[model samples]
Target chain A: MPDLNQAGLTITPGTWLYRLPWIGLGIGLAGMAGSAVLAQGHLQEFLHAWLVAFLFFLSIALGGLFFVLVLFATKAGWGVSIRRLAENAMATLPIFALLFLPIAWGAGQLFSWWEGPGEDALLALKEPYLNAGFFLARAAAYFIVWSAIALWFASRSARQDDSGQHSITRRLQAASGPCLILYAFTVTFASIDWIMALDPHWYSTMFGVYFFSGCLVGIFAFLVLVMGILQEAGYVGQVIHKGHYHNLGMLLYAFMVFWAYIAFSQYFLIWYANIPEETIWYLHRMHGTWSNLSLILAVGHFGVPFFFLMSRVIKEKPRLLMAGAAWMLLMHLADIYWLVMPNVYAHGPHFGILDVAALAAVGGVFMGAFGWALRRRALIPVKDPRLPESLQLDHA
Target chain B: MAFLSPQLPSTEEYGVLGEFDSPRSLYRACSQVRDAGYSRWDAHTPFPIHGLERAMGLRDSRLAWLVLALGLGGAASAMVLQWWISVHAYPLVISGKPFYSWQAFEPETFEIGILGGALGAVFGMMAFNKLPMWYHPLFASKRFQRVTDDGFFISIEAWDPKFDVEGCQKFLREIGATHVEVVLR
Candidate 1:
């Protein structure tokens, strides 16, 4: 009943996130320096990696908000106990909304369509959807809708937890069901608008699902990493048992397979079609420096995890699970860069200072927001009627 | 009723229906009552009671019926939508394919149907269970973890025509229950 800070050593008066904005600034500066010093040809490549990493982080923060809604809508007890963790993830949404500025600022450098191809040829082709006005409008809409939902859900949940009003719980559940459906449709179209449309020449109906797979996997990885950090800090130790980890790991494993399947299917479908227009995207990726990154991703992202996560015991073991989760996190970065960087640079793969610094910048921002949200709330919904059931949950 | 029950009801609050422990014992009791032709009897557990549907004289879930009905509707809509989109909307010829290739369009339709069926099943199950429930009387109990993980329970409602609290409790205990606590109605 006392404030979380007064609950003693479990929660402190202040969160570690207050220090993160400056850290983010430092990383951004370092990344800017690296881009300046990098090879002239590789400059665009470095910029692409930096921007892509920023977008990738932004996408997770956006999708993380959606995850909270779905769990709430389903009245999913197992996840509800740990819903605070995800709420913290969603709290980063506003920062991401602010981030679209830099994206728009450097759009010409990032997306090819912004650059000169022809007076009307490229512009006319992308006219239906790719004009700057429409692009900015849709991006704004997405940000507005997403931020409103995230803030609403977080406030309602936090408020209801204190109020002990049963109707509040029901309202969230009801809202969640529809909210999840809305999330699925919006997220799908948003993916189409943002990443899929980047390569206007190529099209895959499944691209939305592909992005969804990666986002889902990325969220699971985030959950694993956050849970590990929280456990080290001595919270939710009993409430989040081995069973929750196993289920989270299982989701990670499943989504990883899904990502692989979708990635391959897109490739196989395009390859089978063998069209000049469609094949060019793969042609650009599978040759030159991009080829090695693709191969590395194929083997490392899918193959290595497939072998290690196949063992159920490893998923259940916290340390081993963290290893798997951490691997997925690294891959998520690689995957996004793979999608974006090749479009910018056709040269050899380079993990320039910018790439690493950009990652740190975004990651610091993410951690800072995440930590602040968590410290304000209970680690688990201790008053939840189903808390005991979740604590006792065991997986076969 | 610890974890499952946020608040436990007092003994005199609800007409103390009847109760049973392990699922098998509950199932046997239900079957016996069902065979003896008791009409208003139901089993309650922490989760979906395996095989208890049969003992409780329930036929296949009504959800399956809802799914079938929805699947048929979805197929019909899918056909109409595809007709409108591919045939009427753009009608652009590509790869020498027909404008109205029903077979080519069938995969998406069939998928929509199955998806609709799944939706039907979920909603039907929830409706039948009267779920999306925020709170329940059982949530009051602090010892109710076994409902989900390892425990099973069955309650015969006080509303049942044949309901008698003491008699039902005696019958439940006679059916080899480990413990029989009256489920607060």
Candidate 2:
């Protein structure tokens, strides 16, 4: 590890991360495009699968944005060393806005409301809000607002690292409070417009919080995985220790529980209320093969990780933490699958080759973009006021 | 009246108690004592000192395993209780659900599991450490009374195999212990 040098202690990662091989990314894109071409008659299924994969990556980016906002809002110190990772993750927002093109183009095939409400008076009553014009407008608004905030914070952070100005930190703190509130409102509407509107009739007030919880857990898992990779490559372990891993692990664990709590609360309320409108959503998910998927979700998403990450030693151990992180990433995919697929299949679970193709394609592009952003900046917020604290942080 | 009472015998020396001014010094002394293979010894501090536990050569408490076992047992019991009561004793369908619904039992099972874990943590900590005793040999030493204050003390028991009284006292002094006294049982 290099000592603090003339350029205000800039710490750059190896060129490998920046000059990452693109063959895999190219294969991913080709596979995804090929899937859509091969499934010509099954464009509906392709779109549905694409939505799931799209939302999966989008959630990670959104989650990263939220993390950047929260660290600033709370004036957090111990997270500064790793904040660069989050900023890089969040910088993918503009790419997601571009990725939204496919979904927007195929809106007619994907969303039932886009086709105009049938005899269902409920949808008709909600027609104004669910209309294609308003829906697209809302989506655009979400992207613009999110991209602006993410770029603002990331660029500010980058500048601060160079200038070492204290007021920039104060400026970020002041802006975070209002930005967070706007973020909440935007995500709430976005969740409704994108996923909840798929079924048209099914709705839950807790959907926004539930989705946000999942996003947070997904981001934490992504962070853990990235950190593990960096350490394995002999990049960051000198500054980060088991204590940092412990904090990261606890965050992942906490968000997992939060997701469960919101999920269970939604289920319990819908079940207890016995309302036909709400119960219909659960009924669709709970019967037949979907029932088994739901059961696996409850146990795998919450139970297994709950017990696995409970131990302090496991939380601190990099290999074990990586295992949990990989599991969480997979579980997040399963969760998104369960959320999106049940609508198209109606009868039971139906996973296709296209699903895998879409996941890989979108995942490759996302990773490529992430790598580009990561390369453009220092691996750590070198000149942050709290970088010293983050460097010396001890979990105990 | 005082002259007429029988005099008690002098208190026997238990071991040397070394007092340090700060946690760092106490931690250093504990490391030296641990390196010297003095097993029957413990460190006392006004507050928990990080790394001191490692310096004292103490293993992690087994309370976590105890709590986990009890928690799982409680969850099982809760599930069984719900199944028996709902399915066998007085079966009734509510909200069109089955007589024995696993989903319905989750909330109660979770609650009981936490209860079991909480109870296990409290009792297990006490049982593992042999705590809550009204009397101990350390209490016989008048100087030990300041343990709950700013004092940092490390006591090497006489029962230790390598507990040479003068050597231990001199070792404590060399390691920067402010005072060394022979504690009485």
Candidate 3:
């Protein structure tokens, strides 16, 4: 058994993570500057790349928010030890408001509907909801709702570490149900505004769920990777055991399947209906080299990971599960790229240095904020009532 | 003539029965028995004790493999059946699409796969546990009846190579069994 003392639950001095915030910020600024320089001639490509990176990291943060809220709502105990990591991840939501500025600035170039739908009757009919002013307004509202809930839960949980109050947990539990309803609405609209709006003429009610499933897949993969890294650095100690990894792996596997289910559902309906307006969106993706990427997404995102993560032995072993997590993260990026990039490059897949640069810019700031949040508090919610249960978690 | 009836042990004794006072005692005794390399034995309790399977050194069941095999087989057969019907046997182009529209067949394929996996899990579990067992020699012991409520037991069958009635009963008693007896046919 691990020592459950305060010292064991904290980051030791001189650890590499202490430098993460500054280093991550440095890389972030450099990547942003690089993207700026590259955008001189290829402004459209830059915006599209930035949008992909933005959505990728944003999904992870949203996933963190969902995780914390669901844990509180369900009164889950097994996740108590890992809750703080998720808390720190969600606390980075406010920074995404800052990161979203570039997407906002380049919205005209990124979204074709930004300049008013011309000669397209369908887009004209959908004008009020798809207008630029309302889009920005809605974006601001989403940021406000997400940031408020994220900060409230994160701050309360952090405060509970000092006060060690059970009332705080009960209050959070009470608030989680309402917060989740708000989350579902905002997340659905936000996905519609940010991603599905890229092709204004075509729409799928399932798009929100599809994107939400990806968020879950992204966050679970991120959590697995973070847990593995923290354990490797000797930070979280032995409090997190094989059972926790197994559980995280199970969640990751579940959401990965969910993503496929939603993706396939969206496609199956569109394929069966065969309406011109609906099928046009898929036609762009199914043509030329994009088809290969689509096939790869179907197989890589679902098929390979399905069998790879099925075995209990794989999930229990840190290295194997971490490997699976890393691969899934890559596939998640591919999924977002598939969503946004197909709009920009209608002919085929074009992966460039801008994509990497944009990822670094958005991803670096995300990591920097996450590190800052991590260092500010206990790595685990030390005073949570359920910590003991979480620490003693074992699967039969 | 006797093939249709439940078979009774031809020998006078069935095996040794040890009554543990609680699940804790049974768990520890199970570990000892497992360490001592007894193969044909099982523990009975009114409710599950967590990690008791680990204490008894039980390996994971092979049911998952069965489920996967049957699930894939079901999906494959469903797809093949659709292909044969649409592309070869009838070749009716129903929605202005090609004769072989794999897209339309996927939902049924997925559902059938789940059905296969569900059936596999249920039947596989039963098969592994040797279910539909109407008779067990341990049921002959009056104390064993308490297994549905309060009793905890460790029964080692006589067919085990290491079983010696007296030695087994002494071992059980040493391991904190409240009562040890030789169950009969």
TM-score of chain B of each: 0.78, 0.90, 0.90
Off by over 4 Å in 3: A1-3, B1-11
| TM-scores, one per candidate | 0.66, 0.91, 0.96
lDDT by residue for model 2 over B81-125, one digit each (tens)? 999999999999897888987878989998998899999999899
Q: Write the per-residue lDDT of candidate 1 for residues A240-311, one digit (tens) a residue.
A: 778888888998899898898788778867765778888888888887778888888999889899778866
Off by over 4 Å in 2: A1-15, A21-28, A394-396, B1-11, B139-145
lDDT of 3 by residue, B49-106 (tens): 9888988889988999999999998899899999999998989968898898999999
For model 2, residues A273-321, the per-residue Cα lDDT tens digits are 8899889988999878999989889999999999999898999999999
Candidate 3, residues A225-322, lDDT tens digits: the string is 99999988877766899999999999999999999999999999999999998999999999999999999999999999999999999999989999
**Model 1 CA lDDT for position A115:** 49
DockQ leaderboard ranking: 3, 2, 1
Off by over 4 Å in 1: A1-10, A14-43, A115-123, B1-185
- Model 2 chain A poorest 10 in a row by lDDT: A1-10
Provide the lDDT at A141 for model 2.
93
DockQ of all candidate complexes: 0.03, 0.26, 0.71
> Which of the two, 1 or 2, has more lDDT?
2
What is the Å distance of residue B72 in model 2 from its true position? 1.4
As for candidate 2, its clashing pairs are none
